[model samples]
Target: MSEVRTIGILGGGQLGRMLSVAASRLGLRCHIYEPGANPPAAEVAHACTTASYEDEAALRAFARSVDVITYEFENIPTSALDLLEDLRPIRPGREALRVSQDRLTEKSFLRDLGLATAPFADVTDAASMTVALDGIGTPAILKTRRLGYDGKGQARLSTPADAEAARAAMNGAPAILEGFVDFSREISVIAARNADGDVACFDPGENLHDNGILRRTTVPAGIPGPMRMDAVLIASKILNALDYVGVLGVELFVTPGGLVVNEIAPRVHNSGHWTQNGCVVDQFEQHIRAVAGWPLGDGARHADVVMENLIGEDMERVPELARRPDTALHLYGKAETRAGRKMGHANIVTAKSS
Candidate 1:
């Protein structure tokens, strides 16, 4: 394990909290850097630096104290990472972060690698939106270039009349219009790549969304064998392309033609949370292994599992889910439950006959 004992995480949300817990199991420690107080990760981490990303002195101190660094989310400011890169090794690296930070850049990077993504064009204003609409047509999605997630900063344009208002809503942020894909289901592959160029992928999990937030993810994806293999291969290609180290979530649209890349997340992801109880090694531990420069674990599923997100008011049902023998409940220590916020998740595992 190279005797690397401490990991520094860039975000202090639930992902970092779970990662810290996983690190502890492997005899390692975690230090979280986040701007907010009482972050979930801070509760379990060995240390925490509550400083804004713009605070260079705090960032420098955080870098000097850790052996390696990784981020829980992709929205981390590039400038902060640029400073930290000079002081410590950051897993999954800047290239992966750069690719994932912008929707247009991410799509273009995938296209350059000869991967399939929905047709898209950069739209900065009404003029570009008009041009992009001409090529991609209506019934498209216009998403902001940065800081968007869980259905935020995105609008659907079903007809030409809706295009102007959609552009106005974004307030002139750099955006992209993506031609919608007619797909049967949304699936994601959780893959991990180590420093030594070894890659391992968990089973592709089929996903369902409620109001654009991931509602449920079930393994076996109910797809044909070839289709499942295709999803795995696509995830592997993305990890290899970025020379990534850590878990990567590749969201795909399973269309009649084949799997199409929707986006990539360069950290432990929600869809793979079921691995905590369903697999020999969960995505969080795999991420800890990758960032720590250790050998990756067996990415084998031990049970048929379904992961359901506890969104907003869903947290009220914790008592009910906890009563079920087959369900494992995880509640994030968030004080407020705003609409659409991801509060926690529950994993239901069932043994499968060989």
Candidate 2:
């Protein structure tokens, strides 16, 4: 059993901030390691190390200071991870990072597990891009295999003629062409697993994306009973396959054919914010519990919730949002908000009405 008093989080983003708050509830301290100065997590964390991932000395100190290490984001530098893993245990493990760091690898991993995914092919250059387009055809998305999120590093090709522009958008990076899925809506399952191999999954939340960024997620997804079961089962399968410890977010396409896996996030996800108001144990606490070697918590939902993200100028509505009843406002301590920046989120519970 692990006696984790201080948890080390790799990224100091909003997720890290929430994790720190959750750890506090469990009487655990969190140390955040981030390259950026004065990151949001620093406001809540017990300790904050502001240094680049390439700095071995800083990495050594950060790893040695904490009982166990976990990360908010998957794109950590490999060298930094190697140093930290040798000094302390990193939960969710390196294999999860290895698979999720690259979209091509993630898709292949899911495919090998006999799970459904959109058809995808790798593209290295113009020649490969042409070949991939020939196979997957147009009306596909060209995305960088690594380092892409929230609508960045992605291009849409409506016809074969648009391949050149899409390829140019890649900026010479290795890319993947993915055939789109015919889905009615998207949903995500926030799943958790502890070191003991027990798994718990929250009710799948129906997701709505705007400009490729998640705008809102509503609980009691408009899917049928069996699909909900399938969503949970898929999440359990992934947690077990990776031997993952901590919360994982599994995004799926609710298609008429069945549920199709879209992607997986190793850390707590934006869609799971509804759990803050809807469940007894939210994703952040579940993550802290897993990495600290505690038993997984019950994730059953007690109320219907709709979580809406406060992006960029959305901060203007915080006052109005806070004034309403049954609304929980979670704001990240960001000094400035640029366009498309995630300022915070609001979890609004719907009251049962006659």
Candidate 3:
């Protein structure tokens, strides 16, 4: 802990950018190791190593340059983890990564822990998908096991007739078929764990998505008073299960029976961005503290915040939102404005949203 002056981050995206900023605030330097050039994180990081994850020589150099390593996203190449971890510690650990990398494995882990989740089946081909649908029933979602995010690599099945389309979506990749859950709202709990085994969880925030991309996250999720405690407890159970150290985002479906686990993100999540303006310590800083072996900070909220993402062309609205009261804008600094890409976000703070 005392020797942690530099941190190495995998993937140089917006999450990495925020992490780098947080590390700087703590007087720690960040070194980004990403394959892409001019990554957002590289703008704020002290150094950047643009190289492929498969390049062991490059990974070895990155490992030697930093005291500890962490990642911005979950789809990291296992070979990189195997190589870098031998030189430095990777926080949140490999177990968390392994479980969250695949939808089937993640669901199984949750179910095994006695947590509630949607009925699911593994899909490898057209025949397998057909078999999975028979048991999971119609109105299901077919999603790839890896490298899928923000509505990519997924197709919805309304009935047996939709099987071909669902299978086609996989395009030969391994997939999972999940039964749908009729829920009132979707909420995510961002929790953190330190090396000392101390855990701190943020309040649940309700989410709204458009075409699989998160559009907004509203705090005080309107969860029934009693359900709030249960939500936090459920997220804590997952953190302890993996012996996880660093922040984990647990996405849950609010149902009448109880909360149904939807997915788990192994790093700082988009939904947790509201914490930037609402909480004493945001998810980004909490993650940095945990991985750096520092004490976690208070995650309590001082104001109700609604975080709205600027997807693609939404950047046009920034000029207007900038003049709005109590709004904090955080842009990703991406050069291209591809449709559905998260270019930035604006957090609207107040007593609460009506």
TM-score of each: 0.98, 0.98, 0.97
> What is the per-residue lDDT of model 1 for residues 1-354, given as tens digits with 9 covering 90 to 100?
477899999999999999999999899999999999999999999999999999999999999999999999999888898899999999989999999999999999999988889999999878888999999997999999999998899999999889988888798798999999998999999999999999999998999998779999998688888988898888989899999999999999988888889999989999999899888889999999999999999898889899999999999889999999999998889999988888999999899522
Candidate 2 structure quality by residue, lDDT tens digits, 1-354: 567899999999999999999999999999999999999999999999999999999999999899999999989989998999999999989999999999999999999998999999999988988889889987999999999989999999999999999999999999999999999999999999999899999999999999899999999899989999999999999999999999999999999899999999999999999998988899999999999998888998888999999999999999999899989999997999888999999999986221
lDDT of 2: 0.94
Candidate 1: 10-residue stretch with minimal lDDT: 345-354
Q: What lDDT, from 0 to 1, does candidate 3 have?
A: 0.92
Instruction: Residues 202-306, candidate 3: write the lDDT tens digits.
Output: 889999988888999999788976787888999989999999999999999999899999999999999999999998889999999999999999878888999
Quick one: ranking by lDDT, best first?
Answer: 2, 1, 3
Q: Which stretches of candidate 1 lie over 4 Å from their true place?
A: none
Q: What is the lDDT of every predicted structure here?
A: 0.93, 0.94, 0.92
Best by lDDT: 2
Candidate 2 — which residues are off by over 4 angstroms?
Answer: 351-354
